[model samples]
Target: MIPTDWIYGLIGGVMIGAAAAMFLLINGRIMGASGLLGGIIDGTGKANMKERLAFIAGLIGVPAIVYFTIGAPATNVSNNMLVLLVAGLAVGVGTRMANGCTSGHGVCGISRFSVRGIAATLIYLLAGGVTMLVLRHGLGVI
Candidate 1:
């Protein structure tokens, strides 16, 4: 039988897609969080610094607002501070190497029918799936 988590996943996917679509449609720019945040920090976004700052601030603060309004998310992450730091650095490196985050390439880029975006999305998914399989099944980490 299909897992019930799949329904929540589908809803999340739909919401992400819709949000990315709206962001691009309104801004006429890619809805890439990393790029947006990076540009904001570097003062190189297409818009003025104030606008970029506002966007970045909104991105950071809106989730907290929503979580407070609803409820905080539960996570099963390890409590190791060193591991978390290394994982975060690795993710930042991967995002740079991939040229975009999953939301940017998988949702916004794919919506624009970019071949590179599609390939990157497939590679990202395949790599993640393989890594998880190896970690859980082969290494028995989970």
Candidate 2:
């Protein structure tokens, strides 16, 4: 039998793809979460505040709904506040540097055969693998 984690991953992938497709089809724009949030923060998304808010709401609300409905699975991630804060800040900085996050460059961008997206995705994947290898195995920090 397939592992439960694989099943969960598949379901999550489908949901993400569906949501991205819907956002693109309905709004005629790529669904980059960072881009959306950045717009809101800088007042550039004033023209589509409702749309951005709805997208943000879904990002937060869906996970919450799932947690309330079926309980959350054990993530096995570090609970250290410092580690989490650093990781979050790193991700934010990385996303800004890359112009998008995994959902954008890795999913939507790659799906559309964008050169920048593909390049960014490859770089981020490589960096993540190297970081995990170093931090988790080499230094045992994570």
Highest-scoring model, lDDT: 2
Pairs that collide in candidate 2 are: none
Q: Please identify model 2 stretches exceeding 4 Å from their true place.
A: none
The superposed Cα distance between candidate 2 and the true structure at residue 15, in angstroms, equals 1.7
lDDT of 1: 0.77
- Please, what is the TM-score per model? 0.79, 0.89
Candidate 1, which segments miss by more than 4 Å at Cα?
Answer: 1-4, 41-48
* TM-score, prediction 1: 0.79
Candidate whose TM-score is highest:
2
Colliding pairs, model 1: none
lDDT of 1 by residue, 1-142 (tens): 8787998899988887777777768866677777776666556665656656676788779988988899766878988787688778877778767778787887877877999889989988898899789977999754
Enumerate clash totals for all models, in the order shown.
Answer: 0, 0
